[model samples]
Target: MLVDSYGRRIRKLRVSLTDQCNLRCHYCMPINAEFMEVNRYLTPKEYGEIIAELVTLGLEEVRLTGGEPLLRQALPEILTTISRCSLKKISLTTNGILLHRYLELLQQHHILDLNISLDSLKPEIFTQITHGRNLSQIQTNITLAKQQGFRIKINTVMMRGVNDLELFNFVEYAKSENIEIRFLELMRIGQACQQQQDQFIPAQELIDRLKTRYTLQAQAMPLDSTAFNFITECGARIGFIASESQPFCGHCSRWRLSADGILRACLLKTDGLEIRELNHEQRLAAYEQLLGMKPYLRPMEVTHLMHQIGG
Candidate 1:
């Protein structure tokens, strides 16, 4: 088992399969974002081997992420390969644009959770935020996934004047649809930093306001989770990722593996341990060195694009 300098046991890994995405959400990046060449990404077999090796080092959970992970054609094969590993759980974080297309594949592989990124419920605002017209498609997919009994979580980025007004809508939707909704603080990362100073709303502020409308009872958090969850009197589960106003660095145990194979020890840090072309033994050695590089605290500022950093 790999433990960091702070004695935080490293157990979860979030891997970005590709940096390509279909949506250009205002908080993520500009519409015409340029990504790395396809050949630069690790092959399906390579990624499988990497996950397998990490599991041998005490990695317990794995999340497949991307600018939009479903954009990768080999994802099913990749998931199939990793499912054979002795990992405790596997999940996917996506924009939900192509989720319906891969429903069967995800179910067949028994992916434990689906963290869908949906910032707005209003069609017009959703279009404005994502710069895409696939709101209907994504909603349809969400509905279908829920009907099929998938463990679904909606991840919403709360940008001040942009989508913060929809907090009630999100809560109502969660209650009506029987889903979990998480509100994430807008990190000052890459293009998101371009947002007006007034646009970044802390998650705690929203939580405080939510307390007025409903009874919020705090729930015990899972070991690898960063969100603080509250179960409402009405049985609605809401969560907050207070990375800005309240940093959870002391208990953070996950590390990110970028599509190009960089081991990110901190989300706000610009540099990370690169593992792109290393052999199996060399990669393990590099991971050992990377453990020591994990800082006890993050700067609470982001210097890289959130999408490229394996959200």
Candidate 2:
């Protein structure tokens, strides 16, 4: 097991299957940059092996992320492998474009936690922010996912001038559908890094605005959600990821694995130990090195694309 400077045991692992994504969001990229090439990605087998080892090292929760995980053909295979492992929970954080196509396989594997990236309820705004994605398809997929009886979450990146007004609209929409909505304070990274200082709005303001129309409050963890700890006065709840506003670095029980096999101490850390370069024996030694790493500092921000980190 690996313990950081704060004595937090790293257990949650976010595994990036590939840096390639089908949609291009401005916050995630410039909306015209290229995706990771095929050869640069990790194969299903290699990733599974890493997770199997990671589980042995006290990793209990695993999230399958990608620019779009479903874009990869062997995605279901990877899901099944992770589900079969001793990890307590296995979930997927996706853009939801390809979810409807494989909802059954997901349910069959008992991988129910699904987080979808949806910034706007309006189609035009969706297209503008995500470059070329169709808003109608995402809406339809969200509806279908709920009807299918899967635990679903809508992850919204709260941009100041961009989608701030949509906040209340988004909450009303989630409340109507009875789905958990998370208002995330956008993290500045990569091409979106510069915009962080300009675009980021603290979660406190979002809750203040929502309180005008609703009597909601931030809920505690484990009971509310591992991802979102909340309970609403209206009998519904919303999640606010205050990564920048109120850093959870102390209790941050998570780590990220780049698609190419880099074990990042934190997304903001410019450097990481590359486990993929080592042999089997060396890989075990590498895991030990991870035990010596410091707690992820909040100001130490991620430099790569969100897709590259498996957003």
Candidate 3:
């Protein structure tokens, strides 16, 4: 098992398929973001082999992420490779622009748990935030996925004076759809650092605002869960990924693998260990070294963009 100095065993792995995305969310990357060359990313077979190796080392769950995972052309092949592993669960995080196109393929591989990023319910606001014009389509896809029995979670980056006004709207949607909605506080990483001071919203502030209209009962979750979940009186499930307001580094059992094969133990760390060419034994050794490097406390900031590190 890959255990850190703090005794936190790594059980979850997030693999970034590529650093290319269709939408340009300001907090994640610049509108004119320069992406890495396609040739630099680990091939589908390489990703599969790395994930298979990690599974043997106690990685139970794998979450495929990216600048936008759906944008990767080799996704089907990658999924086919990973489906051959002995993982307990395989989930996906996407912007949902092209999700409708791959629903069938995802289901074929048993990847039903999905975390879809949706910052605004209003089309104009969504376009304003993401520089994309497909809010209606994304909403339709969300509904379609739900109807198809996919466990869906809506991930929203809660920013002050930006989308904070729509907090109750998100709660209502969650209640009506009977889905989980997670509000993430903006982090001071990459391009987001410029606006973090002005846009960051505390999870407690949101909870206080929510308490005025709904009674939220704290829900018990696994120790390794990044989100602190709660259920409303109206049967709505909500969660707060309070990275800034309330850090959860103590029980963090997750690590990330960038599309180009760098292993990161913490989101806020600037450095990572590259393991692209490592054999099984060499990769195992690299995993141990990375685990030892895991920080006991969350760092104040990071130089890397969310896309670069596989958010």
- Which candidate number has the best lDDT? 3
Question: How do the predictions measure up, each by TM-score?
Answer: 0.97, 0.93, 0.98
Best by TM-score: 3
Q: Model 3: runs farther than 4 Å from truth?
A: none
Please give the ranking of all candidate structures by lDDT, highest first, separated by commas: 3, 1, 2
lDDT of 1 by residue, 109-198 (tens): 988499999999999999999989888898898999999889999999888778888998899999888999999988888887878377
Cα lDDT over the full model 3: 0.92
- Flag clash pairs in model 2: 268-301, 268-302
State in Å the error of residue 37, model 1. Answer: 0.6
The residue-by-residue lDDT of candidate 2 on 1-311, one tens digit each, is 76655587888888888777778888887667777677777776778788888888788988888778788777877777777678888888888887889899989888889999899988878888888657888889989999989889899999998899998888888888889898888887787788888889998898788778887665667621335556677766688887788777666777788888888766666667888767778988877777566454576477777777756
Score residue 210 of candidate 2 by CA lDDT. Answer: 78
User: Candidate 3, 23: how far from true, in Å?
Assistant: 0.7
lDDT of 1 at 221: 88
Which of the predicted structures, 1 or 2, would earn the higher lDDT when compared with the native? 1
Q: What C-alpha lDDT values do all the predictions have?
A: 0.87, 0.79, 0.92
